[model samples]
Target chain A: MAEVKTVQECASMVADGASVMVGGFLGVGAPLQMIDQLVANGTKELTLISVVGSYPGGGFDIGKLTAGKQVKKFIGAHIGTDPALVSGYNTGEIDVEFNPMGTFIERIRAAGAGLGAVVTPVGIGTEVEENASKQSFYGKDYLVFPPLGADFAIIKAKKADHYGNLCYDGTSMNTNTTMATAGKVVIAEVDEIVEVGTLAPNEIGTPGIFVDYIVKGFSTDERKAIFGEIWQKGNKLK
Target chain B: MNSREIIARRIAQEFNDGEVVNLGFGMPTMAANYIPNGINVILQTENGGLRFGGAPKAGEQNPDLGNAGGEPITMLPGGSAFDLAFSFCIIRGGHVDATVLGALEVDQNGNIANWKIPGKFVPGMGGGMDLLVGAKKVVAALAHTDKAGNSKVLKSCTLPLSAAGVVKRIITDKAVFNVSSKGLELIEIAPGLTEADVKAATEADYQVATNVKTMTF
Candidate 1:
């Protein structure tokens, strides 16, 4: 059985300058309480990897890390949503590495699946091909992207079994399930923890064998309030 | 109709009944609202939801449900969600029937540049390259000219390419075109406009289709 841990304990596991893969598309399925704990812990010089910069209009979710100057670098697919990230990129405060969304996730999948690299024709004739090495099979050209793994992966899930198997709600399973396999240490944050048998085999979005620790996250009401507050703060509600 | 709505409606006609279409964010997303009646077009967002419903009816938002653009939405009856890898399988594996996206520039050869403007706007190309390459038919929906009144359909795009020679059709407020081996073909012009107007507005070289007609919808 996976030992249940505290948010503070999980936050302390992430060292300064550590590479952390956070699972979320903007704010959806983000480990919000864990992110807040990281900020409150004053962790700095971190490499933040995810799918997008943050929520649109910014100043919430991962955007808070950029605001606190905690993220030294950002590796993801989109940066246009968060003004904090864009401003940091322009001022030379944060280094940004851009990748196509699918390719980005595929590289992470490669890492988790124990593959050496990923080759695809996705970036064939664009500037995305500039950084990757090109290889040819027959007559078609494909770009080779190396696997990307992180020191720790913070994943959010709707429910978890005592053994750390996770069940996701809706589209919340963006990069969480994939990042779970790629991280050296994977910590799952969940709203509720159930007995191992409670989560059916089909309900297990991410298997427990890959998960190291489990932490309790905010309840549905708390998460709802947080989203409302963030959107209001970002003027999406106001 | 306004330019954006007109462009959206025109592009909406490109999708036929029982077709799955991926709608990119911003202007291209507007095409969903204008989809022609009785045409059952399925909308897919690469962030991992498909067949999205209108905004939540109760106005109670669920934190987990949203589209690629980060806008809150609901899945329609028979809608489904999947993991990121599976989502991209539907995207990068040529399962998407058609994909509609806004183009920053469309060159004479049907190439598009929509991801970056270098220092000004550098949103990472999010699933655009895969969509263009994997979709059976790729549609470029945008205004005929830019905000500063420069032609967006140009001789060649100065910006970096999102995907090479992938655009199958171009829909704009002023005209509709089909990309072919010989380059852009003007198939429909806006009502009250003539070939001269399209030629004046477009910087790229094009051929006039013999069956050209005025846009009705």
Candidate 2:
């Protein structure tokens, strides 16, 4: 049976040197409180997979962990904003794996979907193929990215019922749904916790079966403000 | 007219009867408003949808349905959604005919500098790299100068480039320039603007276009 707990309690479930997957794109829908709790716990040698750059100007999330040297490896799409991760890579303090944004997300989804690998032509001849397995099929080269399963997946949702049915609005649906399904243990931090069956079935982005734990009663206003600004301004391609 | 409206009107004139194009954030998004009548251009968004016609109205925004920039956008008739991977396949695979993007700086070599500065807190390089690499033709629209009046058209960019040798043309408030292998070629001047005036505002070496003409207003 899944347990209901606080963000700090959920953070306690993570051990040192664990491989973790976090859901968010540049701080949107990230489990900020849980991340802070994990930082406070001071676990060492963690590997973090994230879609976003991570944290408040590099003061939070995987950025803070990377800054503290707790994160030993980072698998992310971009690190343009995280000074700690960028500088750490330059100084050889951290192992960084940079994948294309779309490919990175698909790798996580493949893990969730129980797929062994996903073949793509995106990084076939590029640096993205470095350290990745490659094969020739149908006279064309394809890069086979292995699924990235995690010991723990920390996700954030707008609201959840006691049964653990989750719903996210808009771009918030980026990676949380896949993370919920890919982790050995899934901990969801939600703004509201209501009675079971109150939320309509069609509205559930992640069903109750995928979630192993729930952390209730955390305010997500700060995260919303951070994400809203990025959504409004940062997405402009130019 | 406001600067945005003027830029929008200018972009609308670039479209033909039937073209498939992608619009980047800022001034490029404004192009949706300027699409001319009788032109049936399909607008492809990087986040995973394609629509034609125009921007969405207020209170009708869908979170799941958005452009690459995460803005709530409306879909035209026959609009469709795909995964982000397939959406980018359309970009990097050269299926996209053209892309209009905004820029912070554009250099003589057609390099784009829009993602970040040295120490700013911006979310850098969302999808600009893929668009630059894959688009058939790239068009940049930006202010003629920075807030401090420094030339944004530079000899070389001081910031990291989004793409090298990808920009085909640039349209700024002061003038229009075509990016060539050698360098920038002055093509059209904004109405009532002089060659010396445009040259003084740019830090790049430029040659007069053989067919230089006044930009359509």
Candidate 3:
């Protein structure tokens, strides 16, 4: 079972320089309320681990944090989507770490699953090789990446039971499920909160055990408006 | 057809029935429209969709189920949506048959440089490196030359490399070459192009195939 809290209450728990994992590919599965609260609270110098880059529009999704300079370092795949992130990185205002998409998620999973490290051939001879050690097994060299764990994970879900079992809709489940496991404290921002028995066993994407707190998120109409604004600008390719 | 379309058509022919193919963000996404009529290939989007259809017409966008580029897309009958973890599992676990991607530069050694530009706002490598490392065959599709009329096929890439020696084949606006251990082998040229024209346009040293001929669209 999980405690139900306000977005402000959840955001208040985070401290300066804390490492946070944000779930989303762009802004699809990001915790909208929590991110908004974090910005409103004026949190600073935090580290963010996420997938891909920021959302399509400026001051939207992770872009708000990037624009506010709330994030000191960003560890994820892709950063070209946001102009603020680009300028920040180019001017050395913010530190940036790049990871191959698959490796990024796997590293989070490794931390969640209590594994020591992840070994894969994704970056054998590239600059990714510089950060990780190379281990050759069975005549092929593989890069061994250390696991990544966060102090808090902020994620969005379609629905949540009072006990914190989550359900997601469509591809919006991108990084939420994985980040749910990797965070020391997991806060779920959900569109709907139903009774505990409402979510069937198979329908729950993330079980209650992994979730610590839940907050009501944008209503259907509000969410649709937000999605429209962000995705309409997603016309250009990166 | 335009040069990009021509390149896409040629790469589409490489598909086998039921093959699971991953297309990179830009030019490679165009290949989705040209899959051989009779082939039944499953398309995987790293953003969390499998068997997804091509870009949706205007006013048909669905925010919840977009591609890596955040464009609206549809799914085939048996297609399913999963999380990023599972989508990447199919990619990094060596299940994708082929991956088609665009490149900023590709060298004689088949190394590619498409991920980032030095001193530029790096859009971080999204999924190109994992696709190159895991796919059974990697094909790069792009214009043969840059805007300044410089050859994109090179002896060595000056831009930052995406992966070292990962390209298996390259289909450009001008030619198709197979990257082998020896070097690039010129196997097909565009219509109205001469061997001399290819040689002049290409900076990399390539062996002209004995069976070289104009590509049929």
Clash pairs, model 2 backbone:
A26-A52, A170-B63, A235-B69
In candidate 1, what are the lDDT values of residues A210-232, reduced to their tens digit?
89999999987787677666554
Q: Give the distance in Å from residue B138's predicted Cα in candidate 2 to where it truly belongs.
A: 5.0
User: What fraction of the true Cα-Cα contacts (under 8 Å, chains A to B) does candidate 2 also have?
Assistant: 0.13
Cα deviation at A3, candidate 3, in Å, is 0.7
Q: Where is model 1 chain B poorest over a 10-residue stretch in terms of lDDT?
A: B54-63
Top DockQ: which candidate number? 1
List the candidate 2 regions with Cα displacement exceeding 4 Å: A60-62, A131-141, A220-238, B1-98, B101-126, B129-214
Docking class of 2: incorrect
CAPRI class assigned to model 1: medium
- Residue A40 accuracy (lDDT) in model 3: 94
Ten consecutive residues with minimal summed lDDT in candidate 2 chain B? B52-61
lDDT of 1 by residue, B1-217 (tens): 7888888778878888989889887677777877778999888879887888865533366778777867667788999998788898899898899999999899879899999897788878878888988899999987899888899998899998999999999988899999987999999999888899999899999999999999988
Of the candidates numbered 2 and 3, which has the greater lDDT value? 3
**Residue-level lDDT tens digits of model 2 in B1-217:** 6656666667767766667788876788777776767888888866556673333443333333444543445667687655455666788789888888888889898888766565553344556666777788898888888888899999987776666778898888888888989899998887778898998889888999889988775
Residue A37, candidate 2: Cα error in Å is 0.6
Q: Give model 1's DockQ, 2 decimals.
A: 0.63
Per-residue accuracy of model 3 over B54-126 as CA lDDT, tens digit each: 6555455454666786656777788898998898899988999999999989998989988877776367788
What is model 3's native contact fraction? 0.62
